[model samples]
Target: MALNTIIINTTTTTTTNNNNNKEDKELNSITHFFCAMKQQSPRRRRAALTTFFNTMPYTIDESQVLVMSSLWSMAMTNPTNPELPFSGALHCMSLLINKSLSQPSWLLLHQNIYIPYYAAHIIGSYTIKSSSLAELAVDAGAVPLLLELLRGRLSWVEQRVAARALGHLASYDSTFHAVALHGEEVINLAMKISTSCLKTVYTEFILSEDRKKYHCDLLTRGLGGKEMEDRKAEEWASQLQCWSLYLLSCFAFKDKGCHYLICRELGFLRELCRMWGGMVNGESPAGVGLMRILCRSSVGREAMAGCPEVVLSLCNLSRSSDDWQYMGIDCLVLLLKDLKTRIKVMNMALDCLVDLVELKNLGTRYNVGSTITKALLMDYHDHDKINSVVYRLWELKVERKRREGMMVEEELVKRWSLGEAKKKEGNERFYSGEIEEALLLYTQALELCPLKRRKERMIMYSNRAQCCLLLQDADKAVSDATRALCLSSPANSHCKSLWRRSQAYDMKGMAKESLMDCIMFVNLLVGENREKKKRKVIKVPYYAARMINKQMNAVGLFAGVVTGEGINMQTIEEEEEEGRRRRRWIKEG
Candidate 1:
C-alpha cells in the first residue's frame, strides 16, 4: 500500500478502530516497504527509495514517529553503504520543514541516541553536498538533533559526523540560535579533544594552565610519561578535534557567539590559551581563526584580558612563520586599541611589539622588514585591522624617543613610575653607603622599567655600575656602563656611563681602553658646549652639519689623548665644571 493510503486510513479510522491497531498497521506498511527496499539491488534501491520518499505523506500525525524511527534504524544499520536510503530519509525531513510535522520528526530523531547519530551521518554525507538541502535540514530542526549527537561518550565516527554537520549548519548562518546556545560547549569540547589528541600523538608534556607563567615555558617543557596509543586512535581524535574547532570557529564569528565563548564557565578562554600555547599543533589554525573572530568585538576583546596567557600565546604565535601570525596580529591589534583597560595586557602587547621589531632586525637591519611590518605593507587592504596595530606600535616607539626627559603615553608612564620609585630608593641607599643594598634596588628597578623608557633604563644601569665600582667588581661595572652607553641615543648619550667605564678600565689596568673612553666622554661634553655656542651664533641645519661636527669633535678630543702605561682619566672637578657649563648654557640660551 502507498504510504499516503496508510496515512489516510490512520487519520480517518482513528475512532472506528483502536488507535494502537491503526498505528501498528501503518508501521507494518512502513516496515514492508523497508524490507522490500533491502531486497532490491543497489541501482534499484536508489531509484525505488527516491520514489518511495517522494510519494510518502508529508503530514506527521502522532503515530508517524513509529514509521520515522524504523527508517532511521535502517539508515544507521547501513550507514557506510552508498546504496542506502539516506537521500530518502533526508528528503522526507526536507518536506517536513516548517510544518507541524517537523517538530515530531526532530522529536523522534532525538528520542534515542542512535537516531541522532544516524541523522548526523546522513547530514555529514549528504547535506554537505547540497547547500539548499543543508539549509533545509537545519530548518527542519536538524541542529538540535545534531547537537544531541555531540553530547556524551559517542563513538569518534558519530561525534566527527555531528561536528562536521553542525559546522556546515553554523557556517551557513552564524547567528543561528543553535550556534549561540551551545557555542561554549563546543569550544570546550574542541579544546579538550585537541589537547587529548595532541597528547596521544606526541605525549611529550602535560601543559599547565597556571597563571604563574614562565617565559617560553610552553615551548620548552616536556611531557614524558606514557607511550602513545595506536596511530588510528590519534587520527580519529585529531579529526574530531579539527571538526569541533571548525564548528566552534563558526560560532565565534558572530557577536553573541563570541561573547558566549570568552565569558563561559570553566575558563574557555584559558583552554584556548593552552591549545595555542606550544608549537603549532594541529588545531592551531582553527584556534587562531576563532581568536580572530573573537577579536572583532569589544566584548570579546575585553573578556580576553581575563586570560593573561592569551596575549602570551598570541605573542608566541606571532613569532612563528605560519599563517597564525596573521590571526595573532588581528587579535593583538584589537587588544591594543584601548590599552588603559588592562595594565597587564598593555605590558604584554608592548613586549610582543618589541620582540617582533627586534626579531626582524636579527639578521640585518635594512634587508628584511619585521613580520608585522611586512603584513602591514603587503596586506594593506586589511589595514584597518593589521596596519593600525603595526603603525600604533611604531608610533609608540617614536613617541618614546621624543619623550626622552618625560615619560609619555600613560601606560608607559605608569610602568616608568614604578621603576623611578625604586631608583630613588636605590639612590638614597647609595648616598648612605649601602652599596650592596643599593645594587639590589637598582636591579629591581631594571625589572620594573618599561623597555620604551630607554633613558630611565640607562640611568638605572649606570647607577648599578657606580655601585659595582664601589664593590670592587670592575668587570661588572664595565658591563653595566657599556649597556647604559649602548642604550642611550646619540644626542643624549650618558657621559657618566662612559666615565664610569673609563674608571673600570683604569682599575683593570687596561690603559688603552681607559684612554679611549675618557677621550670619548670629554668629546661628548665639549661637543655639547660647542653645539650651545653654535646655536647662539646662528641656527645651523643640524642634520646637514652633523657628520662634520662629529669629525671636528673627534679631532679636537684626541689631541689631548696620550695612551701610555699611565692613563690620565678626567678628574671629578673637570666633570663638575663641564656639567655646570652645560647647565649655565641651558639657562643662558
Candidate 2:
C-alpha cells in the first residue's frame, strides 16, 4: 500500500468529533498508530512510524509502555515478515552503510539513512528523562545496535544520534552496566569520533560539490541550497563531537580505569581543551566539560599536569569570556589542590589566576575570582614567594600586551592618536612650569591610550612617574615607573623610567634598590650611544655617568663603616640640591 493510503486509514480511525477534547484526540491517534504498525504492509508501518515519531513529545509518560516497546523492536530487531526480512531499522542501517558505495537511489538512501537516525533519536529522547525508561530501552537491546552506528558503520550523521543515545543509556546506574560491558570499545570510539568528527563531516558532506541528493535534502530539510547544507553540516559536526565527549565523560566519571585510558591519550585531552562548542551550539560544554570530569580523578590530574599543552590550553580558556570559562578554572583548581600536580602546573597557571583575581559576576558566584586567588595563595606562607609569582605574572602580561600591540586595529589607532595629542599637551605644560596641569594631562592621556599601544603607554607612564617625583609622591613615582618598565618591549630597558625610579627609591632611602636601578639606567644609555655611533667604544651620557657615580658612592659597602652610620642630614640635603641642578642642566642642554 502507498503511504497516502496508510495515512488516510490512520486519519479515518483517529478522527474525532468537534466536541472531543484534545486528550481524546491524542489518545485516538495513539490507538490508530499502533493499529497501523500491526498491518502487514511495510509502507503503511513505515509511514505510521514516521508520523508518530514526528509528533511525539519529549517526555514520554509511563503509560506508554507499548509505544516504547514497539520503538525498541523496530530499532533492534530484523523484521520477521518474509516480504522485508532485512528491513529492521538497525539491520537496514548496517546494510546501507556496507552497500553505500554502490550509490543507491534517493528514495532508498532517504529511508535507510533517516529511519535509523529517528529510531535512535526517539530511543534516546524517551530514555534521557527517566531512568525507568532507560532501563526498558537497555533491556530491549539498544546498546549493540547503537554501538554499530557509533562505530561509523554509517556516516557521522548517524554516529551523532547513536552517541547521544548511548550517552543517555550510560547515565543511569541501572542501564550503565549494559553500556559499560563494551566500555573499552565505547570510549576508544568516542574519543576517535570526538577528535576527528569535524573533519569527517566536512570531507563527507560539506566539501563535496556533488553531494548525494539525500544528504543535501537531509542537511537542508529541502528548504535551501548549498549555504543551508554548510550551516547544518557545521551544527551536526559540533553535535557529533560534543555528544561523543559526553559519552566519554559518563565513563570517566563512573570508572577510574577509564580515566587512565582517557588521560593516557594526551592528544585527545589537548583537542578537548580547544573544542569551545560555542560557534555551533552555545550551551554545549564541549571539551572543557570533559576536562572537568577528568580532573575529579587523581590519575587524570597527573596526566593533565604532565601535558604542558593541555594545561596551557586550560589557562587560555580560564582567562577567556567563554561560557565554559568557570569549568576551565575548576579544572585548574582541582589540579592545584593536588600537591604533586600543583608544583608542575602552578607557574603556567599563575598568569591566568592572577588575571582572574578581579573578575566579577561569574554565574552567581560574584566573589569566586578573589576567593579562588586567596585559596590558592593561602598555601604560600612566605610573602616573598607570592610576590615573585605576581612579579612574573606582570612580565607575562606586559609581553602579551606588546604582542597584541602589533596588530593595530583601526579604532585603536584613533585612540592612540588622541593619547599622543594629550601627551604632547602635557609636555608643553611641563615646559611652561605648569607641573600640576602637566600631571593631570598625562593622567588623562594614560586613560585615553589603548592597552595595545604599549610603546605609547610606556612613555605616558614614564612621564607620570616624573610628575609624581617632582610632586613629592615617591611611592606613586615608583609604581608608575615600574609600569612603564614592564610595558617596555624588553623589561627594565627604559632609560628614563629606570632613572626616575632610581630617584624615587633614593628619596625613600632604599639605597640598595636605588643603586641597582642607577646602574641599569647607565648601561642602557651606553648601549643606545653604541647603537647610534656604530662603534665598539662605549660612552655613557654625562648625566647618567654622574647619577651612577652618586649611587655607587651612596651604596658603597664600607660607606656606613666609614661614617659610623650612613650619610648625615646635611649631606643628604647637598645630594638633593645637586639632583635638582643636574635635572635643570639636562633640560637646558
Candidate 3:
C-alpha cells in the first residue's frame, strides 16, 4: 500500500511538470515571434507575422508586456520611414496589388498589407478585456499608428482592425485622450468610413471577381478557398463599419464640436437608419445605437427631426420586434421631449406613438409608452386635433374591451374550459395529418378563448399560424403570428410564434423582416438556456444557426444593386407609407 501511494504521487508530479513545460514553451514561442519581427530580413518578419496572426487569436495573455510593446512599435512605425520613431528596417517590397505577380513580389505585397493588420489586431485583442492593457497600449504610441490604418493606409481590412483597436483604447478614461488628440480627424474618418465602407468593400472585393487573385491568398491564408474569402470579406466589411461607428460613439456627446460635426452630416444620418448591421450581428445596435447617442444632444435631435426619412425609420423601428426596438423608442422619446423639436417631429411621430399606447415591456418605467404619448398630445399646439386623436384611440380601446367582455366569472371559466378542449382537439388533429380541420378548430378555440386569457389566445393564434404556413398562405400566417406576438407578455417573447412568422416572411421574400424574426427567436432561445442552466457560454441550436446564416446571405447589404436586382427606393417608401396609412387612427384629425 505504501508503494502504490508513492507511485500515484509520482505520476501526479510528472503530469504537473509536463503542463508547466508546455506553458513555458508557449511563452518562449511568443518571445521568439517578437524577436523575428525585429529581424532585418523581410522574409523572416513576414513568416513571423503570418504565424503570429494565425496563432494570436487562440492565445491571449495580459502578462506579456514585452510582446505588447513590440507589437505597438511594429504597428505604429512605418518601416519605410527612417525618421519615424521605432521604425524598422526598410525592405524593397512593392505595395501595389498585382494579379500577375511573381512569387517573390506576391510575398512582398503580402507582408506590406498583413503586418499592420495583424499588429493592430493583436493590440486590439490584448486591450479588449483589460483597461490596464489598454493604458499600456496607449503609452506605447499605439494611437497614432492605429490612426494611420483608420485613414485607409492599406485597405478597409486594416481600417477594421485599426478602428476596433482605437475604440478599445478610447473606452478607458486613462487612454481616451490619447485617441482624443486626433479627435476631429478620427471622428471624420470614422464617419466617412462608416457611411462608405460597405459600398467600397462590395465594389472592390465582391463585385470585381477578377481582383480576387490579388487578396485571395491573404484572405484565405492558403488554407481556405473562395467561399472562405467571401465570408471573411463580408465579416470584415461589417466590422469596419461597426468598429468605425463604435469609435465615433466613444467620442459622441463628449465634445460639442464633434457632436455638431456628426449631426451636420445629413447623409450620414440617413445612412445610419438604413445600416441595420444585418441580423447575423444581433449584438450590435449598429446605426440605432449611434442614433441613440446623437439623440441625447440638442443638435442631434434637431437634425433627426429635420430628416423626414429618419423620423419615419424610427417610427417603424419603434413598432417592430427588432433587438434594438427600445433604443428606437428612446430616440423618438428624446425627439418628443425636446420642446424645440417636438413640433417638427409631432406629425410623423403621432401615428406611431398612438399605436404604442399599450406597449408594456419597452422601457424601464411602467406604461412608459402611454406616458410619452400623453406628453406629446398635451404639449402640442393643436389641442383640437390632439384631443380628437386621443378620443378616437380611447374609443377603439373601450370598444375592444366591451366586445370581449359581458361574461361573468362562471361564464368565463366555462368558456376557458371549452377553449382548452378545442385546443387539445386541434392539436390532435394537427398531429394526425388533418391540417384544414386543425386550422378550423384553432380558429374556433380562439373565438371561444377569453381575450383576458392572453396566454391561451396567444397559443391558439400561434397554432393557426402554423396551419397557415402549411397551407401556403403567407399573409394569414404573418397576421396570426403577429397577433400572437402582440398578446404575449413582455411582447415578442413567444418563440414558436416568432419562428412561424419568420418562415412566413421568408416565403414572402421579405429577407430583412425574416432575418429580424429569426434573430429574435435565436436570442430568446439563448437567453432561456443561459437563465435555466446558469452557464456562461450559450450555444445556439444548429438548425437556428443555419437559418440565420442563410438569411444573412440573402439580406446582404448592397447586394441587390450589385446583382442587378436593386429595389426601387421610391416604391419602398410608398409601401412603407401605405403600411403607416393602414395603422393610422387619427388621420387628418
Candidate 4:
C-alpha cells in the first residue's frame, strides 16, 4: 500500500508540473503579442491590446506582471538570441520598420520612427559575422526593409545601419538568392542613394567655402554659402555613400550577383567608374572594390572594354601611390590573363597593361611586376586567335627577359674576352723574356677571370707560379702553386703545380714537404706508364732513388752541410731526353 501511494504522488506531481508549463507558455505568448502591438499607433495599440486581453483567460496580476517585465527586458537586452520568447515580436518590429521606411505616411511614422533604426542597427550588428543570424534576419524581411530604408529619407546613421544589414544579408547564398529576386529594384535604389550622397557631398563642398573679396563676385557668388555648417553633414554624407557602395559591392561579389547586375544594363561599368572618380582612397574602398570585382568577370570585362571611362579610371588608379595601386594592377592583370575573352575586352586589357607598364617605368624602371605566366598558358580554349594573342604576349615577356639577360651576358663576355687577350699577350711577353711585364699581365688575367671558369683560373695561377719561380720569388711561387692545386681536379692530376710547389719548398729548405710532392709525382708518372707502354721500369727507379738520396742527405749527418736546394732542372731534362731515346729503341727492338 505504501508503494502504491508513492507512485500515485509521483504521477500527481508530474501532471501538476505539465499544467504549470502550459500556463507559462500561454502567458509568454500573450506578453509577446502585446509588446508587438505596442509598436503600432495609439488607436491600433489600444484595439489590439484590448482584443488580446479580452480573449485571454488570465489577467496581469503582480507575478504575471513580473513575468511580462522579464520578457521585455530580455527582448531589449538580448534581442540577438534566437531562443528568446520575443522572436515573434522582433519579426513584427522588423516588418513594421520596413513599412514605415517605405510608406513614410504620418500614421506609420508616428507609430515608431526610432524603433526601426535601433532595430535595424542591432540586427545588422548581430548578423555581420553570423550567416545564420543573417539568414534569420532575411527571413524576417530584413532585405526589403533595409532596401526601403536605403530608398527613403533616412538619417546617415539609419542609412549606414540599413546598408550594412543589406550587405550582411547578401553574404549568405539563400539570402542573396532572395536579394537577386528583387535585383533591379535593389540595384537601382542603391545606385540612386550613392549618387545622391555623392551629389550632396559635392554641394556641401561648394557651399563650404566663403567668398574672398579679391575674387570676382560673379565667379564666387553661386559657389559660396556664408552661413552653412555643412562640413559635419558632408562627412556623414560621405560615410553613407561609402556604405552604399559597400552594399553594391556585396551584390557584385558573386557570379550570379554580377550577372544580375550587368545583365540589365551594359553601361553599368560607366556608372561605377564615374562614382570611382569621386572616391578618396583611404576614406572609401567599396567603389574601387566593386570595380575590381567587375573586372574579374568575363562579362564585366567586356562591359568595361566598351566603356572608355572605366579604362581611364583604372589607369588613373594604377598610377596612384596608395594601397589600391596593387589592386588596380591586379584587376588588369587578371583580365589580361584570359586571352579567350572577347577581342574588344582583350584589346582593352592590353591597353590597360601598356598604360600600367608605362606608368610603372616612369615611376621606377627596374622593379616591375608580372602576371602568373601559367594562367596565360592554361588551355582554356582551342581558338587560334585567342591562343595566338596569349602566345604573343608570352613571347613579348620572353623577349624582354631574353634581351635583358643577353645584355648582361654580353657585358660579361666582353670582360672575359679582355682577360683572355691579356693572357695571350702575357704569354708572348713571357716567351720574349719580359718577366716583369708578364707578371703584371698574368695578375690582370687572374683578376678578370670569372668565378665560373675554375679550370682556366687554375691554369692562370699555375702560369703565374712559373713566372714567380723564374723571378726567384719562392714565397710567391708557393702561394700561386698552392691556389692552383686547390682548384685542380684529381682525375687530371695537377702534376705541374705539384712539382712547382715541391721545387719552391726545397728552395725554402723544407725537405719533408718537397719529398711528399716528389713521391706523388713519381706515383702519378708510374701509373700513367703502366696504363700505356711498359717500358718505364728503369727510369722510375732512378728518379725515386735520386729523391730518396736528397731526402736522406738533407735530414741526416749532412743536414748542416746540405742546403735542400731546388731540383737540377737542366740535368733532369737531359735524363728525360735519354729516357725517351731508350724507350724508342726498346719499341723498335
Candidates' C-alpha lDDT: 0.55, 0.69, 0.71, 0.57
Best by lDDT: 3
**Tens-digit per-residue lDDT, 208-318, candidate 4:** 364222122212323554333233344455566667777777777764445434423433444455443222224565456777777666656655555666765665455
Superposed model 2: Cα runs more than 4 Å off: 1-110, 382-387, 390-589
Ranking of predictions according to lDDT: 3, 2, 4, 1
Ordered by TM-score, highest first, the candidates read 3, 2, 4, 1
- Model 3: lDDT equals 0.71
State the lDDT of candidate 1 residue by residue for 363-404, as single tens digits: 122312244444333333543544355455555444444555
Question: Predicted candidate 3: what Cα RMSD to the true structure?
Answer: 14.2
Task: Compare candidates 2 and 4 on lDDT and give the better one.
Answer: 2
Model 1 stretches with alpha carbons more than 4 Å out? 1-47, 52-119, 174-229, 276-284, 341-343, 358-589
Clashes of each: 3, 0, 0, 0
Q: Is candidate 1 or candidate 4 better by TM-score?
A: 4
In model 2, residue pairs whose N, Cα or C atoms come closer than 3 Å (at least 3 residues apart or on different chains), thus clashing, are none
lDDT of 2 by residue, 139-257 (tens): 65678878887987666777888899899989888899999999999998998888667666766776677787656766776798787877787788788888999999999888877
Q: Provide the lDDT at 264 for model 4.
A: 35
Q: What lDDT is reached at residue 368 by model 1?
A: 22
Q: How does model 4 fare in lDDT?
A: 0.57
Q: Cα lDDT for residue 401, model 1? A: 42
TM-score for every candidate vs. truth? 0.41, 0.53, 0.63, 0.44
